[model samples]
Target: MLKSDKLERLELYKDRNTQVFLNKFLSEEISELEPVYDPKVGYHYPIVEAIVGSVQDAEAFLNRLYNAGILERRLYDKIIYCPKCGSANVSVRYCCAYCKSFDIQRSALIEHVKCGYMDVEENYKKGNKLVCPKCHEELKKPDVDYRRAGTWCTCKDCKKSFDIPVVAHFCRDCHTAFTFEDAVIKDVYAYTLREDAKEEAARGWVIIAPIRDFLLENGFEVESPAFLKGKSGANHMFDIVAYEGK
Candidate 1:
């Protein structure tokens, strides 16, 4: 379709409302939609999840409602993604920068007040005696002689030192490795009905109930749940149909 033609055809109700998500949302007392995540199910976002329980093409149904402007999405949650394929099935782990090993331990760094020097606490160990690395002085009192500066992570494999270990994401599904820069951060969203859509849904069959009754009182035959064939040789069903002089 042409861009201008598509833009002009973007009219409301051009497509029929399936009311799949809307019916489920309206049925709920609390319409506040949120994303619920489980390790087994990955991610479940309200109405879409509810409708997809019995159907296979849940994404298609959601896309339809979204395209019709009946469903509005709100930022809900976030997940880590694989840089290669943009898959969310990824695992995060801290590794050593030098050897890229997972075997790493963290320890506090001690600072000598006398010499104004800071090093790892393990460096000050001298045969069960705390010694200052800088001045090489025997530390008697901990508070007076030295204090803890910060913590440092050391790689057991390569014996390399670092303030913070390198964080890398591993794609479990595709078996891919990506650095923090390469790792993609994606936002998940919760779906809700638009205000106009909610009003339309709220009206529902109640709107047609009065019209059907009026037609019945004025001597007209009403056929509800009527099935008819369309010009395209497709079966069309109507919730209500009225016939005059029948």
Candidate 2:
């Protein structure tokens, strides 16, 4: 078996910097942590991903941590994903609605106010002479007989013209095409320590380690994580308990 291979059961340790960060939040919650941007991954990772090493299932782990009152979530950036496969690998493309071809070109259109003839700018150009295509009138000045109307695109493949192209998304990974309505939008979140969890860490294990060592140095017996029954018939774990002069 590979040493790195995950098993069904294994011992895990907390109270590392990752957990201590939760404990240290008693002072104030950390915020404004910059994201880690990876060009290859094509996504900006949450700051906690940069801090934690063993974050394989990032979404699940962060959600579980949030449920455990260890971390709180703050609204972060948002991103769009492929609705079909939920992949972030997507691109926006403008294509002709009739033929759905990307081979389209846009050009200006000129309208002759005198004859009420509207055509492309190229049709009105006759060897540097702006001649009206309808009445064959030679144009002299702007707004006199001709005026620039609008612009449109024509599909070179199908020869179909349109005023507006349809918006679309192409999934580079799955090779599937979809419209904007089929796209999935997801919001990412930043994390901070919860107020209640921070308050518990004040008299919790955050300072218990040093206190335990101090008691042992003074010729006293100290039991860390001391378990005792309360009057309510419930067991409670205390951070430290010391006894002396036995």
Candidate 3:
């Protein structure tokens, strides 16, 4: 059961924006509000953005509702961003382990079973045919004369060979290069309306109907679920708006 005083204090369903936002869930338009990752804006809720007009506003509104127990949030993802400018527009780079140069080439390593010779595939190339560098034997087919053992990499700048390369990140927004240690990690969340709140919202008008009856019996013209413009130029909704001889 939901407390009427708490709902009134938080201005929950009475607000027009709150009603519209929750109606999407009541009508089954969306099951959950998932956070979409945008390079320029980081994690955002597109569905909420369409209603609230901006990512920042959507974030604030959703978090407020979540804190008030109207919505539930779950961790969706953990994304890495640029610590310098705090942007999620980051790309990965593979560099040579020895010299940290991006100029590198990868090749498959071939092994000749007969002579037990293993080397890069380039060394086995001979006039459109595979010839073992150690035994000088013409390789016919795979698993018979030779087989692919693994892969190897060579750095063109430092002339160094290695099995793995170093991983690094570059920010597209700020043009900054950094490793995982220097990057910022943020947790993204997805939101959904709470089941109890959904039930309460369905019968919200019933709970506030006594106020409407009281105003009508007092000889005042009343409007239930009325919208009025505020001083800030924002429209607000009320459960009952009573007018005196208007």
Candidate 4:
């Protein structure tokens, strides 16, 4: 059971929108609330948005429940956003490592295993036949004569060869260009009801009120829902804690 304050906090779920959100889990419609990725919004819980009005409102409500220990949250993904405007609508841009030019060509590096000669595939093309540029050997079979060594890139503007390119991001919303170091990163999480809270969700708080009244009538000071600290210094919640004189 939740503490008295936490139980009071549960009253927020009584709102129609919140009930609709919880009912989905209560009815076993969804076991976990996973976020859907949106290019415009980054990561959002669609079901929560549909029930709770907006994405921001849905996230706030889920966060509140998590804080109250009613829901458990797990990191689902991480998204990068534009730092300038804080928008997730960003596009990735790969540029040449030398001149930062967008005009670059990608080709596979082929190696003649027989002679240990390696070069780009384009240099080995000899009128529909692969001929090793270094050894001038006509390739016959894969692994026998030549094999794909690796992928290589060349900048057309600078005519420089490189194995890796410079990565940057462009914000569609603010039209701002930035690198990974300048982008804002946020963690997205998925939520599920706490194991103990599932049963309480299925049965409303009304059932617990009568039990609390019965204890009070029997000449006892009762905390309907209480937090008790254990010997280990851990606080555990109880449905009822009653004291009859000391």
Instruction: Please name the candidate that would achieve the greatest lDDT relative to the true structure.
Output: 3
Model 3 TM: 0.67
- Listed in order, each prediction's TM-score against the native is 0.56, 0.51, 0.67, 0.74
Q: Which ranking of candidates, highest lDDT first?
A: 3, 4, 1, 2
Error of 2 at 211 (Å): 2.0
lDDT of 4 by residue, 86-196 (tens): 899988888899888868898999999988988999999999999988888899899878899888999999999999889988899999989889989898999998787
Deviation (Å) of 33 in candidate 2: 3.5
Cα displacement (Å) at residue 13, model 1: 8.7
Candidate 3: C-alpha RMSD to true structure equals 8.5
- For model 1, the stretches where C-alpha displacement exceeds 4 angstroms are 1-20, 54-56, 81-89, 110-115, 121-151, 171-186, 204-246
Worst 10 residues of 4 by lDDT: 5-14
User: What's the CA error at residue 110 for candidate 3, in Å?
Assistant: 4.0
Q: Poorest 10 consecutive residues of model 1 by lDDT?
A: 4-13
Better of 2 and 3 by lDDT: 3
lDDT tens digits, residue span 117-214, model 3: 99999999998999999989999989999999888999999999999889888999899999878978887888899898887676664366567667
Per-structure clash totals for the candidates: 0, 0, 0, 0
Expressed as tens digits, the lDDT of each residue in 1-246 for candidate 1 is 233222222232222334444666677744755666655334655445565652235556665666666678877777777777756678887899888886888889898889898888889999999998778998888789988877899999999989888888888877898888887786666777777666654554446556777889999898654557899999776656788945
Q: What is the Cα-based TM-score of model 1?
A: 0.56
Across residues 128-170, which tens digit of lDDT does each residue of candidate 2 receive? 8999888999977888778888887788889998888888888
Q: Which candidate is the best by TM-score?
A: 4
* Candidate ordering by TM-score (highest first): 4, 3, 1, 2
Q: Distance from true position, residue 140, model 2, in Å?
A: 19
